[model samples]
Target: MKYPIIIVTTILLLSSAVNAQKRSAPDWVLETKEAAWQSRDSQGEANEGNFGDVWYSKDGLDWTELKSDVIWSKRHEQSAFVFKDKIWIAGGAAEPDYKLDSEVWSLKIPKRWFRDN
Candidate 1:
């Protein structure tokens, strides 16, 4: 099956009510190795310092975690794009050492999963 090319964009405008407070982007990674680093510190291992949680938002205002601990290694600064009915993540720095990642990961998204707006 074929799917249309979908482009996602987000824009945030601050209003007076939110101007006094600090807010992170809605798509920010909520989980990472650092969240558990303190307890695992004594294990004699450096924090992998990446995130494996997958998330999706239809409206971009509300996001839900789609999966936790995906097949790909935890990474940041990865490039994410939709190609051939699949979402692909490629080439990000894996944490702890901040070394470059060469692996590519992708997940197929069914057309039925999307609704016409």
Candidate 2:
């Protein structure tokens, strides 16, 4: 009956999860908190999506919002994660008419998280 179908579905889902993990290696788990932070800019975004931010997951369950230090005021020019423990953002439309640039900017985090490098 319907009860049997429900039990079967639950078993299949649980088995699939166990099998998937059987193929992966284990690493440091962060168990991060959930948060949302802003990224880049939206002044020149398409319709409304003006920025790109990232949600960090340590245990693949909770997420943390990683934020940037600046907002881009122009169009097209992407940003990316460029280093360990931080992000690098650059390349956006500025004044002087649709120009391209190689200028890169690295945003700073709190001094406590800064390691000797």
Candidate 3:
């Protein structure tokens, strides 16, 4: 009697809390693909070229393109990480050559990227 009532109340409270904690999905989706590229040594084609664009989110719901002028080239399978308050991207392959790049590029976060377009 009393035990059943307490159990029902606890279940209702837990369900309400779960419903309130639901989160909305991000605004932008990165659609990247490994494009086909001709190999240099005639070992067949290598699917290493990256075909996609970069996007940025201002509020997790509103997104915008990062602009093509800023990016050096389109690449995939690159290593990107944050260090010393900057975002670093390095060592990615592009089309035509598909050669592994040895260059490092960095963008200072917030200060460099948060400006109005």
Candidate 4:
């Protein structure tokens, strides 16, 4: 009886010490959430004429979407990047006559629009 009690107590103490050590250490595992985006290719099938919208996330969890507004003119294979406090979406393909096109576009985000941050 006493022996069993001692063994259980020892096991519990060991587990508690291990848990404490883990809590003190930095957490290495990442927690990710499922976020939905208004992917233009929302599916991989490509049919023209602006079929989607803008969506974004912070934690990659909760999402906010921009309604159907022409964020850009018709495009495909567009490469989007942020530079000079502006987003540049350039070099894409266009339909109604699939042709390779190069374009430089800038967004009008207020304050220091031309400065690179």
**Reference-based lDDT, each prediction:** 0.40, 0.36, 0.40, 0.38
What is candidate 2's TM-score against the reference? 0.34
**Candidate 2 positional error at 79, Å:** 2.0
- Provide the lowest-lDDT 10-residue window in model 1: 33-42
Candidates 2 and 4 compared: the better one by lDDT is 4
Tens digits of lDDT, candidate 3, 43-111 = 223453344344443322233445544554655555665556655666666556867877676656432
Candidate 2: pairs in clash: none
How big is the RMSD of model 3?
A: 16.5
Give the 10-residue window scoring lowest on summed lDDT in candidate 2: 23-32
* Stronger candidate by lDDT (1 vs 4): 1
Model 3 spans > 4 angstroms off: 1-49, 111-117
lDDT of 3 at 69: 47
Cα deviation of 44, candidate 3, in Å: 18
Per-candidate alpha-carbon RMSD to the true structure: 12.3, 14.0, 16.5, 18.6
**Per-residue accuracy of model 1 over 1-117 as CA lDDT, tens digit each:** 211112221222132234213223322322221110000011123452444555444433333446433355555666665556566666666655668867776655521122112
C-alpha positional error of residue 112 in candidate 2 after TM-score superposition, expressed in Å = 13
Backbone clash tally (model 1): 0
